[model samples]
Target: MVAEVFPLADIGLPLGARVPDFTLPDARGRLVRLAERLRTGPVVLIFCRSEGCSCCAVRLRAYLRALPELAEFGAALITISPRPPVPTLSTEDEHRRSLDVLGDVEQRVFADFGLRRELSGEPVPATFVLDRQGVVRARHVGVDHGTTMEPADALAAVEAITLG
Candidate 1:
């Protein structure tokens, strides 16, 4: 657990609130539920626009590089998108395949989380940290790709929840 709490920017989901539970298919077409994953540890939900977005690629790659720190906290890295996981859409070279990119087919999951881009219907790049008990600890929501939270910020959130 993160003993020294770092200051947060702003989040849409209230702190300590329980988020909605839903199952979405992973890259392998396997159904994965948020609640089920919480059983193992905290989950860092990365709400990405698409593999095409350059900003998202940079942030995601950073997470990929920080896999060691994430594993220490027993946290899972999941990138969510409204579009289906296309085998051809290599968002950021080969390293992207290391991340679990799930598809929110109907976008109901995204809507449930209230993930929306400013002045656009697209989902904004956001990161949310949910503790093992299903309570949201911290989150960073962005209006656009350039403003999304850094991968290190997400890691900090995960550490906070896991250690707390």
Candidate 2:
């Protein structure tokens, strides 16, 4: 499917809000559509910092560890990074993650999701758990280099959406 990006004026994308669909390029250079993934199950959208951030790596590993369980519920985990480094870019190729480490080069998608970095321009962390209908179920937006949620906790949020 083609990319669908909802205008900021159209939807605020707050909690319990119906998320507008988006299309982004995965690490493998393939387009991933939010609407398409929602047809199968819920989605875990992680807005991460660049490769220079330490916690980004930790969070990636944690989520990767939790992927199997997330997939059991037919949920998908995706990371959106504005300007991910070379090594960080290889992560998907290295481990063959089931999810995409999408590149948001323009950060337009980032802003479309109602996200902004710190005053210093260092990317912050944010997580949104969306159900099959594309309505946001859970979310955590950080202020600085802070992380949003632990992988397991993120799974719990997704579970609440899927199982509840």
Candidate 3:
């Protein structure tokens, strides 16, 4: 069982707290900066276990299916993992097959976000929705096998932020 901790480090990113800006490479070694992406629209950042996590895989597939639609609102969905870089070909293919499949293996960014929660020998699953200004608008930390934020709910949150 996952122990409940008071003042969970990964819960409730405050409405006005600025998300620390970061530059992490995508699957193809392309650099992506939080500041740069925010210039266009809201960024939905998903920090998950690199690979081998079944829950992460399921979350990625769900994001992959929802990507095109999410793009309509100019919201960029990004998924990062601590998995080491795969071969160039495999990396590209994986990006095409799953969620953005772009992330850092060094865990620098992951550590910065405080998403690393060691539970039962596995890292906890976490999600953060950051507005264009870099403030975290929504946050979810899950310890369950099926923990994830639904695409529709995320989209609605973005829409509300944009319209407001």
Candidate 4:
């Protein structure tokens, strides 16, 4: 007998490319469209599994720690996952905890971004920094415990974009 594994999609968006539009409801069930969200400022899109994933948690902690500073750089952080809402915990709660972990329970955004993969029965991990115009400026995929995006790095990217 042979075992079969699902193929993984290339995680990160290519540099200097525009992010495709996607609309998913936040935990509050309000529609959040990427194009609409970016009208204010740049956006950091964090893609992960559930809140229980260790690496996910670590990455979010980094984002949480740097939220205030990242805001100074003029970026709106948001996250997505495929996990549906639960009884005790809601997607809104996830967003509140991290200010970036929006719920993508429908998997629409995952499919649109080519990040839909089953890496251990969980969604593939990825991140993207999109400018206000929705072009992906930087991207990282498949995180390790210590591997995550830094606010300083994002600030640098924003400076480069705005200056150029």
Candidate 5:
């Protein structure tokens, strides 16, 4: 049997594909379902390695800073990590409350989303903009370990989806 090869660009979920529904627990242990969030408006899904990773922390913080702008577009940010959620200090409570930090300890959601790195088996730092209908409008999957999608680009994707 011949092996079927997929192009490098097809490594992760393609644009226009409908994302599978998933339910993951947030930092506060509250269950957040993807389908439920879609009911409100567009959703920005971010997949990161771990909270301890400096790169991941930077990506998360950037998104946190863009939360207000994202809210203006009626888009919600949801971050998924392979490890269990660890509560942060009280100082970040307000920022943390704006987005949902989900824990996918089993990595099931990462696999389902096709964001797993082939070699490390870790979730690739990815940003997906899903419209209210659950269809992927834009996606950026990191090819390098420390690389992640920029907050402005993600917001632009959401803006386009919201506007168009």
Candidate 6:
């Protein structure tokens, strides 16, 4: 008998589930609340390992490149990591400046989202498309080091929420 393997995305916070509201500090030290942002429009919420992770950096840049389209759809992009934000190289700094990188220093928000890795307790990279009502419209939890939802898919998800 063969046991079917399910993707990690399927395990936590099933589809249509209303995400819990929480507050975390952004790069500039401003507290950002989930409910508050929801009042404006849908959000592309990303969970990443840490500010220093190379894979997470790549994922961040991908989303950064998609910012204009996301703005067109009236969806905000926010990234939360287990560690605090740090200064980066000049080239990367410019791109990073455009993103609202929140620090989940205590990993409380990660825990609330059920996004921690089983062995290391580090955050597993994930992307969640949330509607204005704070319900999760789409979610993609990465299976390993460099896996994550593509910007195109996330944009599509946001487009659905905006159009529907």
Which residue pairs in candidate 3 have backbone atoms (N, alpha carbon, C) closer than 3 angstroms, thus clashing?
Answer: none
Residues 4-108, candidate 4: write the lDDT tens digits. Answer: 344333454667778889877665666667877688678888887776777777776677666666566566777777774333334453454324445777777
Judged by TM-score, which candidate is best? 5
Q: After superposition, how far is residue 28 of candidate 4 from its true place, in Å?
A: 1.9
Across residues 1-164, which tens digit of lDDT does each residue of candidate 5 receive? 65444354766788899999999987678898999878888999988888898988888888888988998887888888899887662335345344788899999888888877666676676888999999999888875647767889889999998899
lDDT of 2 by residue, 40-111 (tens): 888998887675678777778788888889988888888888974243434543354447777787777777
lDDT of candidates 1 onward, in order:
0.72, 0.73, 0.68, 0.67, 0.82, 0.80
Clashing pairs in 6: none
The alpha-carbon deviation from the true structure for residue 127 of candidate 6, after best TM-score superposition, in angstroms, is: 0.5
Q: Is candidate 2 or candidate 5 better by TM-score?
A: 5
User: Could you tell me which 10 consecutive residues in candidate 3 have the lowest summed lDDT?
Assistant: 89-98
What TM-score would you give candidate 4 relative to the actual structure? 0.76
Clash count for each candidate, listed in order shown:
2, 0, 0, 1, 0, 0
Return the lDDT, model 1, position 54.
84
Angstrom error at residue 65, model 1: 0.6
**Which model is ahead, 2 or 6, in terms of lDDT?**
6
Angstrom error at residue 151, model 2: 1.5
| Cα lDDT for residue 132, candidate 4 | 88
Which has the better TM-score: candidate 3, or candidate 4? 3
lDDT of 6 by residue, 1-164 (tens): 65444468554576899999999886667787888878878899998887878998999888888987887877788888888865352335335333467889898888788786555666667889999999999988875758888999999999999999
For lDDT, candidate 5 versus 6, the one ahead is 5
Model 3, span 1-164: residue lDDT tens: 76756354444344567878888776567677878778878878887776667888777677767776666767777777787544333344345432344566667676577665444334456777778898888777665637788877777877776777
Model 6: per-residue Cα lDDT at residue 136: 91
Clash pairs detected, candidate 1? 1-163, 1-164
